[model samples]
Target chain A: MAPPTTPTLAPPDAPPPSTDLADAEPDTGRKRGLTGYLLLLPAAVWLALFFVVPFYSLAATSLYDPSGSDFRGYEMTYAFGNYVDAVQEYWTPLLRALAYGAAATLICLVLGYVLAYAIAFRAGRWKNLMLVLVIAPFFTSFLLRTLSWKLILADDGYVVDTLQFLHLLGDDGRLLATPVAVVAGLAYNFLPFMVLPLYASIDKIDPRLIEASSDLYAHPAVGFLKVTWPLSLPGVVSGTLLTFIPAAGDYINAQLLGSPNQRVIGSVIQSQFTDAGDYPSAAALSMVLMVLIVALVLVYVRRAGTEELL
Target chain B: MSAARPAARGTRPPAGRWLREHLVLVLGLLVLLYTFVPIAVVVLMSFNEGTRNVYAFQSFTLDNWANVCEDQSMCDALWVSIRIGVLATLGATLLGTLAAFALVRHDFRGRSASNLLIFLPMAAPEIVLGSSLLALFVAAGFSGQLGFWTILIAHVMFCLSFVVVTVRSRLAGMDDSLEQAAMDLYATPAQTFWRVTLPLVFPGILGAALLSFSLSFDDFIVTNLNAGTELTFPMYVWGASQRGVPMQVNVIGTVMFVLSIAVVLVGELGSRRRSRALSR
Candidate 1:
């Protein structure tokens, strides 16, 4: 409320240096170190116990014998084959999740870039109001929003009808229970993630740079490419990762808006744990997803020419 | 921050320039409209008179709004969510604010590692976090007792990272000279912190708390995994979606939407008034 809910405007990758860290003096400053450790103790301990320890448990579970049931008690036989088996069985959904996530991230970038650019450079006195509007849609429950999308894309709904009228869709073709709806839902849900970071980066660019480019012989398009796009790469990198990681792991949109045929890896992981009670298989799949994302993000951050990402 | 400056160049044709200048704004508004289409549906359908089984809006009526709690389970789930959201926010904000202060105001070894640790929870997908927490609980023999306490732990764990980031930014952006001046004016360390630091950081804490509440309240995937048989609002909606959805769900959604918007509007107006008074 104090700053109008733009708390996330700060780039996640580039954390500000601590007061002492930025100081010219190079010593650790023993008193400050003591205070720092004291203050950091509770959070550090909590994260270590719950956040860090759980990964160990998950990894251990992943290597447990796949034949063991929850009732029968799992044996940690170090069955690394669970990873191979999980991938073998669920490769299609895994690939589909990555594909869907990539498409949604790209769509979010396009739509979000337009909105963020408008708010950044063109909104005059309406800037604050527009920024608030950007976050307003997110405060509501995401499940509720996805459900509303369900209704909006219903078989007999206006969207489908309008599409048929325009001959973009066949008379019998539908938006509901389709990959389009799932991807659309993903893009809509994660659009804010994309916009906020882009706005944060784009807003910081001095307008004079763009003006200077135009003042030269450069066309407006060339000026934008030379000035705006390169300056906002940090935001683009972080925004895409923020949108893509969750989009890849989300099952809610697929579950609510798509048929069983469109199940993503998230849906598979969820069902494996909840319905099939296959903890080992679920754990294996979860680890795979986490590893794949981490590896991809590392490569992406490197190629994006930014080392700021944690 | 102001954009009232005239265009940099006046040589272009007026008509083409006007279109080019405003094109992104128009396209941006359309994108916003796309985001709001579903929220509009939620608001509209709150007045719908559809019965238990039908998904369509048949006629307009206020029955759903009037009897929002008619479905006892929905009310119960809503209460559960509210309670969890409050507790999680308080826990996360307190611990995270302390962590943020440590990171920003002081220097220590393992600082980079600590920063990465704080960032990891936010980066990981909800499904992975939820599954790993559930695994820990099961392995620790708390499998059968996975209910209120487990949900609270998971919520705090996830929310803590966000709180840290928000408060850390606010703290880092603040000027330390104000605190130094207070201390030089014969103020005790506690007095300086309470009078100078706390006021400056309070807004970040408030924002973090609000963000945490919305996140915990709207959360479905993590809460679902650790909730056991205990139901939250999102879980209620998930369960109802598979069967017949009560219109009361829409009523609650509308209420939440209205309440959050009202809060934002009031804050905006208050800030505007304050700035006006200061300028005068």
Candidate 2:
């Protein structure tokens, strides 16, 4: 989820002194030199030790000799062949995860935009209440909520029956253990990630700009296209990245709501590590997924012109 | 209210006009309702009587709620989750608050680099984070001891970034003149900090703590990777799902939902009241 950066509600009387202090001379400003470093040292060290060092460990683990088992211990063979083997064996699930993630993210974007827009522009005095409602349902256990989806979309459930009755599904069509269920589950779980960022941006839009466009004879849709969409690009970029990253790596939906056919890269990696004890292959797969997501995010962020989001 | 004025004046508005005007709100609400469908299921299933087909409702009964601990393992897992959640929240909140203050209140070298560092963990997928940590643990020869401490470390690592972002935003948006005024009035630096600054920043800290607790408690992916034999609530649920989930699981789920919503509502109401008081 996007970090909820509450828009600054600067008191009416308080002059915005933050920037003024920044512009002031160091001598005239608050003491800054050693205290800042002192404060930062703990977290910086924590991140360095746990976060940064682990990446190096993962990289090293990815190169270990695949012939070795955990009990016998592995050799540091620097086996680049592990990557090749992983790709050769698991590429289907890898690509499937990415495709599912993309489909789910697109779905979330449309649904999220409408909900966010309504909350921002239409909810009036009910804005905060509606925002709370958006997150309230999500406060329940994620696994439990997802399990509910399994029951809701079961073979005998109303959703499938309704679809069949509406002539949208075949008489024997089932929802559980299907790609549609996996994607829908992904979209449902990650919708808040899309909505919150979008709401943050859309809520900041100056309503007068839309009115001004209308005053100049622009159609409502045209006004939205020219003003609202461009202004909300930052949120769109962040939301899509947030949604896509987790969705691609997620296996819970695929495992619970889907079948063997819907297994994703995450499930593959998990099974390889725990079940197969093939640490090298699992590490290689994880590294590949991370690299691919990072590459896609970079290109997407660049194209969207929201580098500041980083 | 504006749309209701003409109707109040004894003129019946066109049904189509009203629908068109409020279309976005209706659509938005429908989406919200859709999100809650699963929660509704969870709540409804909490009261369901025991049946062979756990997925379908059999009959309404309160036995599950009454005997939430019938499955002793589930309660044990819940306890582990709570302990880890509280410890992780404390560690993350302390380190993160300090870092947030450093980033927002003072100028420093490598500030941009630090910001990027904070952002990267959030951007990285949980699978990757979990795998990387597991790899590290294996490499360090602690693979045999993958349990509570390891889970706590992973939770704090992930939750740290979110805490920093939350507190940093609040600190950055804050006005510092109050502190300056306190100094002008001859109060000590610590006095001003404890009295004025801490009180204002406390809400953001509390919010971050709550966020961290929820994230830690509900985590499964990372915990499953590091927790060799220890079970968390989510892990227990995942395990149960493979066989047949006990109705008591739904009881716990309902309790979590109700409790969290209560907390959020209370916080929201308190903040609103505070703002109203401030305005006066």
Number of the top TM-score candidate: 1
Q: What DockQ does each candidate score versus the true complex, computed on alpha carbons? A: 0.54, 0.51
Across A138-214, the per-residue lDDT of candidate 1 in tens digits comes to 99889989999998899988889999999999999999889999999999999999999999999999998988887
- Lowest summed lDDT across 10 adjacent residues in model 1 chain B is found at B1-10
Q: How far off is residue A17 in model 2, in Å?
A: 16
For candidate 2, write residues B90-132 as lDDT tens digits: 9999999998887776556676678778878988999999999
lDDT of 1 at B7: 54
- C-alpha positional error of residue B122 in candidate 2 after TM-score superposition, expressed in Å: 0.6
Clashing pairs in 2: none
Which window of ten consecutive residues has the lowest lDDT sum in model 2 chain B? B3-12
lDDT, candidate 1, B113-178, per-residue tens: 788889899999999999999899989988899999999999999999999999999987776667
